[model samples]
Target: MHFLTHNTAPCDSTFSPLYSVVFGCILALGLPLNAVSLWTLLRHHSLKSPSAVFMVNLAVSDLLLVVSLPMRVYYYATGTWPLGNLVCNLITMLFHNNIRSSAFFITFISVDRLLAVVYPLRSRHLRTSSNAWKAAALVWLLVLVINIPESMHFSKFLKELNGSSCFPKTPHRSPLHYIQPVLMFSMLAVNMVCTALVSWTLSRRLNDSARVNNKVNVMLIFFLNLVMFIICFLPLSVGILSTNIHVRPLICLASVNCCLDPLLYYFCLDAFWKKKEDVDLPGEQQLKDIRSPCVGLE
Candidate 1:
């Protein structure tokens, strides 16, 4: 979304209003959705499952982005950045961090499910809750390490633009110029490979009516990740490599991933809920015994 706003070529003013609306909508939807998701993961589900661990990390990443939206909304709405360069850099860092972190966590979840279906016995040790949490920690640590250059140089870019508004601009041949596209495309590739594996495994298991519901639920996970990759990740990744594209809107569009991710939670947990429902409660079992009037118990 960065363009050289020199006197020869003034920045487009129209994008400010559009950005305002987009950020506003993202804040409205993303905030509540992520909050509830975090609560559900922490309160209802123990983070002992690999899926739950990945989801909780995803929710935490989304909340980090969600918290930064207010400043973005203000910047766009007022068409200014009264906030200092430090605040601006922090906001930019959070934005990029969430995008990368979310991508990794989503890919991890896809692979986790794929392994669960494809190599249930072998993957059992690999997919433990402890391993999942360790993976999550590694993702955060790696994201911070990778993004340090961006954090250090972000304010400089804003200062160079010499505008009242502060937005991330990609300068050709810069460090970020190389890093973002590479990272995004890598995540996209991993997601595609994982999705293909999940699909193949599910297809092979499709004939088993006993596991039909479970397979369908897992397939939905692939479908959603594909959708997220297409709509959010693809454009941004490709656009970063091309000078002709204005990437600002696409970056904002990526925020939709936060809201959409909760849908994955629903699908992933479908099997869990089904199993819960299928199990008879102790009280129900007692009532059945009373109704049957077992001779010895009577």
Candidate 2:
């Protein structure tokens, strides 16, 4: 596993220009879009819907992740982690939290959709925003608690050794390595299960045109989530599989997620998608009314 050869070393970027560009794009674009999305989801929309509440939190988590990427940019440009040890722990926690929380929120959204379609009558009570926020709150608390070890156990530069090369300086804390794998597997597992449910419900709903809009939204969101899941965790998974064996960073492709996530936000700006329109009508007047700055979707 990568943990053994990892040697708690700092990674010097031979790919600085590449990663710098990528991280910069994410920082410049993802942060603002995610923040606006969060604001729209919170103040502008009625959080009484479980789905909306979760979406709001999802935006918040994504924003947190976006905000943290700048540090990565700085590291890439400087080729050293000048931020000190405490920042290392915070950055690790923030990155993992954003990824895990996003996965769970997507899974929750998929399941909520499935129930609304598969069991409409039962959904009224179960899908209330109050309950949705409660469930999302519980997930947030659990994710925070679970990642505490990664945050606290995190070790940075021993200073005396590998001063420039930063890594998981887990001093006598080998248990920390397990944290990444555990979180990765847990997220992938949950996403798989929830995605299956989303597929099943969407299949049934496909027969009815009235449901197609929501279906499209869910499908797009699901696909977006699946992509994010793969990108965010696959490298970590590969590193774990090869036992972190590869000489180079396993997943350089993950850099695309920054642009991709923002595209999802632009997708949200679509009137049909945001309002969950039953019909895809082409009326500038109607679309404009719904598309106008977020105002608690009815």
Candidate 3:
């Protein structure tokens, strides 16, 4: 328990209030958003497609992370960890696992879109719902394998006069920490490639107004995914390697992604935002008919 004796006053003073408020906001917004996203995805039979499968998994990851925020909110608001070490470890692991898993699922969504747009005919066999599920399972397995050790390594409780802290700054380093940034960058690279290819493919079809519009919409989704990837995960990746940067803010920033992910669900699944009546009426069915060219490709 010698590691617990180290002074963590600076971290507590800087992060406690900030984390409390930030995490509270995330919980309030993210919980409902992700819950609705999951409900919408599952309700509409959207899981039939590979992209929808990835979206469903992504929503699940966000929900898992969001559900754990209340514990974090209490800890940061009160600056104490009365939940015990086991719960603290679980929470830490959930945070790490979900963030990276969200990235992986987002990358998968981009790649799915890329294949649908850029290599629709050739990549047909690769873009099945079964493959998506298998890929999602692999992502979870890989993330758990990578993060379990790292979470355990860094989740040292800090003893305070009042109580113990769940997550305190530790001077120790782990190889998994280094690997995290590499994995994030590699996923980022994949998103970039997908975005570029999709854009080029769309550019060639600009002569067809309707087709080009649909492809542009598809391209925008990938662009948003790339932007979100850079905004949410890039800072943490950079902070991992740099000594001067505080990771608390980066983590908080990343938490916002849980709220933003529902937007992807809205755009990717046409039925997500549609009302029951709107979906059923023949007059209003034109909305569904304007499907993306990449719709059935996945």
Candidate 4:
């Protein structure tokens, strides 16, 4: 619970310590690693490839989320929404947009890799750094547009009822309750489908030994996200129908997402972070040999 979550102030001396510790840990891990990921992708990798370009933007999205966490930390500690409406709106927008962008871009990254492995020659034409940038820009623009209604929907002040500041105190008759779940689940479904397709394509390309290793590593990341997406989202999406408006379950699930998110990101694209020089395994020697000609062309 946050210190300043309105409706009911999220400030129990008992729980505040736990919340502080969690956010502090996330701030520590997300900032440095996201910074390094940003640098490695920008300066150390071949951005000529779309996957590399998308990876750079993905790191950027995560870093943006990381940057905003401190505000939440402050809010949790002080138990105040002192930032006002404008800052709160920007914070909300940034958080949601980053979330949408991350999920979509992960799918895009998977597709990029699948395309490269499945149809190298044809895919090469469509995969360029500049084009990747355009796609990334489009994602931000679209997600921002999708989230615009949210900014309008949220209220910074309640009518003396001591309600939540970040969320509106509008009547239950308002449409946002339905709209929010629909939007979230739609995005989730799109991501799941895209990931499945990519996984299938990639699996087809892997030889027996490579297949086993890839399944172990890649599925570890993918399925964890899939599982969490289901369990965490169930309350936010499905519990709307239930009369019990218990926010604690949803809050707990949401925190799980944040805590596990770093691990998911680490493994999902960790292979790309490895430079050409990092390998010693004989299994991947075949891949290097196959790509040596393309490497030389660079």
Candidate 5:
């Protein structure tokens, strides 16, 4: 069912300008955002919520992709991969790992927020930082195990006709190829469900003004995450389903997710709304005063 030829010609020179622009933008934006996110998460001890932990891991995944961009940019700039087989394979591996790992971590963030809103009392005990760390660890392990073989075999996918292209050129079918489409859609389904449920639950709490504001804040944060998920992944997912479409550009577009992730940090970790409100309302002030004496911070 591989409709596209495996050994497609070397990418046209016309495409290199687009690739260079895209890769350059990703590099310029993704690195500093991820770096600042990593720094802020580590420095601010108050930022260690369950969802924040997932954001931290997401930043890590984005940083990996950012670090690998220069080589990709160079390849596009020259219209070839002169970096030899090992570097090419490793770069391909980074791209593969970054996308899936980002998806899984964002999934965790969505579910974590959904549980918090849906089962507030239970979520207090259930959503611990230790558990978040454990979950993040498991995601890394799973992604690495699933991706390592494909990455190691990336060199085999290349053909040296016009020049060495890292993208696969043969029309042969493989289990990984089949599994990828399934995985993309499966994760996408979970994200869409979680987003819908979280939004619905938050909408119901709008009657309680005090809780309403907080719920709205959390809901908006989740909404940002959901929007990013669709913006980054939906096209790639669609391309996978429609096998005739060349997916490399969509893949590059998806990488922009890492850059947008820092927006979540600003919204969630920085307490943007809370700071702006600054306990301006009497009810909010009273609530803050009441909660201020508590042993644990939210």
Candidate 6:
């Protein structure tokens, strides 16, 4: 999806193998991680917390990208899109939508943590599970609205290619292309602010062991969110701004975030990796002891 002038030349042979290998790895890792994340969120009733709700939505977004990778892997490996135009458009849209939705959800998680850590009592009313669900709904709606035109633009196959090319470099730049960099940067800024505030809050609690530990956990959540933005979304945003940079490899790098997202789930949800028995143990005291830093259940 690098913006290039419409030309008949086939995609760079060198990058095709790279895409196949990278996308294959993403599919292999992302599938099980997100699957288990989703399962844990539902099976344990983790959705009681707003952060858990966002985590569930994030896992779903990652799975959307994971399931679409097989076809992308096939196309890159064989240099053809046997799936045809409709599927091509769909895959393209899914890729973009996943990227945008993932960014938004990750930011939501960070903001959830910020509220939980910095303004716990005050934000309690705003951080309800219902509000989280509403926020997730808005993210999906915004992603769909942004990608609709891109899907229409992507509907046509590149006829000049030797065979079907699902995402050949197109010379024409859609207005949406310009919007992506701005969106990525804005999300990055939000994550950074959340991370900073969480870190500062942690510093204030160093003398109290339990509160410090809890604040550290909150810091870790925001830190990972910032890292995801920098590593996954930064290059693609930069690539979108500069035509001289190759965007295909950046896109592949961006896809790596799908695998990395499970880390957020593990850290954001205290019950994500805990045994079912442990999570189900009786008593509100036990639950409070293990409450996620993002939940501010205390």
Off by over 4 Å in 5: 1-15, 46-48, 159-163, 167-174, 206-223, 241-243, 272-297
lDDT of 2 by residue, 1-298 (tens): 5543333344433225566676787688777777777776655555655556767777778777777787777765555676676676677677667656766776676566555544555555676767888888898998888776656555533344344544332222335445656666676677666656655655554445534655566567667767776766566544544432542233334434544655444555643145442322123332233221111233
2 against 3, candidate with superior lDDT: 3
lDDT tens digits, residues 1-298, model 6? 4323122234444237678998899999999998987897777765657777888898999999999999988877766566667777777778888889999998888898787666765675787878989999999999888777776665543344434466654233566878877888999898888878867765664446666676677677767777778878877766766656667777788899899998876664545644343222233343334344554322
Error of 1 at 186 (Å): 3.4
- Stretches > 4 Å off in candidate 1: 1-15, 168-173, 206-212, 269-298
Best by TM-score: 6
Residue 128 in candidate 5 has what lDDT? 77
TM-score of each: 0.80, 0.71, 0.82, 0.70, 0.78, 0.83
Worst 10 residues of 4 by lDDT: 289-298
lDDT accuracy of residue 204 in candidate 3: 68
Q: Order candidates by lDDT, high to low.
A: 6, 3, 1, 5, 2, 4
Which pairs of residues clash in candidate 1, taking residues 3 or more apart in a chain or in different chains? Answer: none
lDDT value, residue 297 of candidate 4? 12
Worst 10 residues of 6 by lDDT: 277-286
lDDT of each: 0.68, 0.57, 0.72, 0.56, 0.65, 0.72
Estimate, for each residue in 1-298, the C-alpha lDDT of model 4 and write its tens digit. 4424442553322224355566667778778877876776556565666766676777777778778777666655554566666776676567656656666675566566545544555655566667778999998888777765666654423323243343222222124446656656775676566566555654666667756766566567567657656765545555544454644335445434444445544564544445544221133442333221111112
The positional error of residue 84 in candidate 2, measured at the CA in angstroms, is 1.0
What lDDT is obtained when candidate 2 is compared to the true structure?
A: 0.57
Residue 124 in model 6: lDDT: 59
Could you tell me the lDDT of residue 144 within candidate 2?
80
